[model samples]
Target: MKLPYAEIEFDDTGERVHPGQVKDAASVISREKATDVIVICHGWNNTAAQARDLYTRVVESMHMVQGEVPGAASRRMVVIGVLWPSIQWADDVDSGAGAGVADEQETLQDMIRARIDDASVADRLVELVPRLEASSTAQEQFVALLRKTLPASTEGEDEAAFEMLATGDVGEVLSAAKGGTDAPDALAAAGGAAGIDPMGVAPLDDGGGAGFFDSIMGAGRNLLNLTTYYTMKERAGAVGRNGVAKALEALHDAAPDARLHLVGHSFGGRAVTAAALATSAKVSSLSLLQAAYSHFGMADDWDGTGKDGAFEKVPSRIDGPIIVTFTRNDKAVGVAYPIASRLARQIGAGLGDQQDPYGGIGRNGALKTAASLPAGTLLDVGGAYAFEAGRVSSLNGDAFISGHSDITGRQVAYAVLTAVATGRS
Candidate 1:
């Protein structure tokens, strides 16, 4: 279905694809005399169509629960859907499904093509994949190429560990990926919850020795996924901080009286938060659905090292409550964050779980922030919430948020509306 809301898109470098769309969406607010502007951002989608579908589902769910929010019936709200160049990993790339070695090599090639923008670099990377299982020289060259292709990013908590991508032993890094999280059962649980087969990683020793190149091929795939995770994370932040922030500023100037509500899913959550941090736009509410960022992203001093989180200033910028949803059912964030820790050389049994210092916000919740309020689990459609303004509320969505992409549910819509209502003067 075509997106009913105004659409704004950005390129990989955070430049607006169509600069006029921001003004056009702002004009929409003025024409409709919208009292509120709901901006929804999508994360890590392969195509514009998938992103549009997400926006449609979210708006549909919100319409169904608007009545439950006080004063929502009288509100005239216009929606904006933000799109960016985000890529999704191929299922088999991480799953390590029991496919033949030739099939696995082909799968790795497909993954490289999907995530890497430069065709030549991606082709070179693909060539290295087959050799990964047999040659250390090929392994070194692959890691170097991967590091050189990715954009320079400063989003991680450990700069030294992140720098290891460039300077550390290439062999050890790939080995860490081989020893990374093995969670087919976790994926199964997530799939069961979502009623769909979840993306996952299978053990290399799953019988028959798999193949001669199985273990090294698995390591290459995992490294690719890990690097892709960080790449998308940085790209999302750039898009939000520059393009989305500019759009919202334009909208705010055009419709000064309208309250702005920002809602984002996955990496989009980081985008919206980054946009809010960058712009002077007066945001009334924020709803982050299964966001993929550090659990300590908003923390003032998560490890007592006197260092603040990357988004330490976000909570104060919003005038209303920031509602963040988290769940264990999200295998994407679950598996990715642990690999992130492993890449950073931080090892622990609970690497990606809530107890881990390196957990993603979607797997756990916003942690160590001064604005954090009493935590609550995500509620049913008609359930009540005591969301307070100028605070951060971490709502557990384990009961309802079955998977990473399962954020367009009725319960989530209700929570968003409730937060918006709570922000009203």
Candidate 2:
């Protein structure tokens, strides 16, 4: 195939290759040095497309950083593009159950989040997924990997199964949708506030709790969790359990030097936490894109904790650094209101935070990233890739600034990728 995108390199004497082709070529990539392992996880109702197995952003981001720090890519590092079954979160919930044509740029951002441990440091993390005693299917392989790769001990509630989906009862949504209600409406009735308009059934009213948009931002913060596709939806006895067990068994037997780096987008972000809290998998870190705890169902707050609840159990178990990338102007965030409303709310909540990081998508369809950073820190990790974005695009053809997703978006991807690539957190 003809190679496009000059920035991407492929020694295709054997075959002209592109980034897409390089991403999934695990064997080819594995042959390279094992310096840093970066695994990317995708968001809800979606699966990481390991097809052809090439990570384009990994290459692009690496090159971008190398320009500043030199030798960023050549460093002993293994770029492992981890493809997990995610629920596939998207901006247009109008698409039937996340079965939508995805924007590559948005998807790529989510992938970036999963590769870093930022999501794992979520208020809480779930237990490692269980492995089945039989069947080494791709899903099962991952479960086994977690079982063997994580630490020997942990603490948390193992609310396994695609608990959230089951909670809403996919049957109910399908039944109502089949009965003629629009899919969004059906989903609202099942999982959101009464009269949700955007996603259909729930208005997601922020209530008097905070500025409607800002108070609801907690939802935006966790919106990425929706991107994960349902898998090991099986709990202890469910299909996911056995698959996890089998995978863990194999991992337990692997060479001790073997390490696992989890990157989950959207719902997958929560799953990664689950596996981490459950197994003795020797993991370097976790990255969450569009992250939210799966087991933590629809609730009154972002904390998503409850006494005797699985999520409550989860937070108490995993302790690590976590990074989250969210946009105040995210359409899905429903943040059309003024930022002042949110600012006041933050003050009311006693967060002691004072920054307007998300500049609304302006008239020309340009989105600005106005985030707050630690003193002397740019890019939230490495000042190399981060820029004070003002809705500008490197592409002139279609203005490919990027699309929306739980983890991936032009700005969000840059934030997460720069953080991880530079080993910030």
Candidate 3:
């Protein structure tokens, strides 16, 4: 079907858009004289087809909103859907594995072993196994081994390298090994008083020397999960900052006067925010639906200026409202996000406190940071509601929204369209 706005598809890497295609897309938007360009970013675990389906639904629902809201239909609109490699294989390790694997624990260990072997850390793993078995606290020993074996500096390496280790740089080195070259600095900056350990595992009972292997295996599994979680987080941020950010800049340059509205779900939230933060173009509205990014990402300042959240200065770039939707029903963000953040040592250490240093925007909205704006509005969107301009609005998306992937709902589309239509004036 012919879309109202020119449809542009980005690859998983978010880097390899054909020059001709880009020119064609720019021409389409420029020739259409679109006053408003809406960019949608999909979250994790979505294929290109799924992302397209979601974009279609959202655009259709926006049309419905236009039909209802006066003057909305008269506005010329352009839609851009961003598709990236947000899905991590480790996320589905437990569920995607075949039923034949009776032991999930063994499967997790095998996955970790494979990752280590793939990274040429098999010899290191072998060496650590004995240390892990010998140590009274297997978990601590395993963590130390990971810190010791992984490379400290990953300046230009394409793959994981264990060439050298730096003193007193365990977390940073391990972060770089798990994620990429940029991870060490990013992770180090994020480090502070550990909040809660979301995936905090208890040490197995010391069975003298008999249960040593079992203990090591458990610690291995936990370590693997933590490493994978952090890697995914860093990857998402990297894609947004590097690849997606460039694309958005190109789009902005093509249609400088166009009113920009961004919609991002799950990790796509991180992507869009990164794009906004990086771009000098003014954003009309930013809508985050079950955003998996830190709740304080858009804060003005956090923790006495030691380190800023991902989107700390985003408010200055946005000309209109910052809309955030959160629901307790989203298990992925509510449960998994915090745990992952804690495991990565991004937040203060326990399950989570009421303040929720590790909580996601999808679970808790902006929290303390929501008050940063004078006109900041927080509401429960159990029914139809209207949002004002130049404000940061947090909506309770319980009634209409189901969960993380529930971005295509009529209510959500209406909220987005309303935010755009209102901000245009």
Candidate 4:
């Protein structure tokens, strides 16, 4: 089915806009004389079709909400779906199904060693090492190559010590390479030393060490996933800052007085905030639905630097209320987010403790932020929740939202409409 809203597709870099589409989208808003423009962004690992389906659900839900709220339909609305290439890895492959041979029962250490010695992975590394040696500024060149080779969603600075490997320090590089082979054992030993489970969970013995090996292999696979996850986070920030932000600036120039409302799902939350920070676009309302960004993104002061949180200064840019939703049912943010953040920190991503806390905005509301107005009010679905201007309202999404991808429910649509209507009023 066709979406009820206009759609604008952006390339992977978030810079190039599809020709004729923006003008057509602008025409729709102009024709309707739309007072409010709602832009929706999707999260990671979604195909274009999936994004469109999500937009469809959101539009339908908004229609339902408008039916219940009198005078809601009187406001001319123009909905736009921001389609950016934010996918990292395919869903099926990311499920850890074919990572290790099912029949081969190996310990966690053995599994790490196997991945380290993986012929395909090693071959790529071997090819990369020579290229590093052949180039000047070998470290930077190598990192650039890795940024190209790695399946991260965003491009970012290399903070990890992998650059040290290319500084004519063959011994250090070889030692680091060798350390990869010994990582599992070292990690397990450290865990044992700390009086923790070496297998990362309860000791499992399903005969022949099958269960133990499976657990170890799972952890190893998670490392790979962490790489992609961090990449996606950086990419989301880039797309928002560079691509979406620029686009919004241009749109505002064309329609200076137009009211803007941004709704981001998962990583899109980071993107929308980045867009706001990157531009002087005056936003009316910002809604983050199960955002997969740092919970401290809206903090007043983070890590003594005052500029640590991704959206710390977003309030200054927005002219109205900022609404955020949180739920414990989002497994991606609840379970995988902290693990990925911890691994990214270990690799020198320079992710601060506050910005890279154990929980996400999706699972927990904005935390450590003294500036939150009303301190994150929890709203009931279909209930009257008028958002106060220049404040943040954190709503509990457990009643209507179930998981990371369930933001298109009727209740959520109602809540979004409430925010929009309240901001416009």
Query: Residue 163: error of model 2 in Å?
Result: 11
Clashing residue pairs in candidate 1 are: none
Tens-digit per-residue lDDT, 81-132, candidate 3: 7766554333222222222223544454555565442355544554455444
lDDT of each: 0.77, 0.30, 0.57, 0.58
List where candidate 1 sits over 4 angstroms from the true fold.
Answer: 1-4, 89-94, 180-214
lDDT of 3 at 81: 74
What are the C-alpha RMSDs, in order, of all predicted structures?
5.1, 16.3, 8.3, 7.7
lDDT of 1: 0.77
**Per-residue alpha-carbon lDDT of candidate 4 for residues 1-425, written as tens digits (9 for 90 to 100):** 22236777777567656856667767777777877788888887457887888888888878767766544667778888888776533122222333344422232233223323235543443344433323435434433333343442232222232233223243332222222222344322323222332212332233343232234333333433344455566677777888777767666766666687889988888888888788777788888988877677777664455544657778777777788888765666643343333332332121222234435777777776665765444455457775776677888777777677888877788777777877545
Candidate 1, residues 43-83: lDDT per residue as tens digits? 87879999988889899888888888776777887899898
Across 255-311, the per-residue lDDT of candidate 2 in tens digits comes to 233333445444344445455555554444444443433222211232334323233
Backbone clashes for every candidate come to 0, 91, 8, 2
Name the weakest run of 10 consecutive residues (lDDT summed) in model 1.
190-199
> What would the TM-score be for candidate 3 when compared with the true structure?
0.68
Clashing pairs in 3: 194-348, 194-349, 195-347, 195-348, 195-349, 196-348, 196-349, 196-350
TM-score, model 1 to reference:
0.90
Best by lDDT: 1
- For TM-score, candidate 1 versus 4, the one ahead is 1
* TM-score for candidate 2, residues paired by index: 0.41
What is candidate 1's CA lDDT for residue 395? 94
lDDT of 3 at 265: 81
**Ten residues in a row with the worst lDDT in model 3?**
155-164
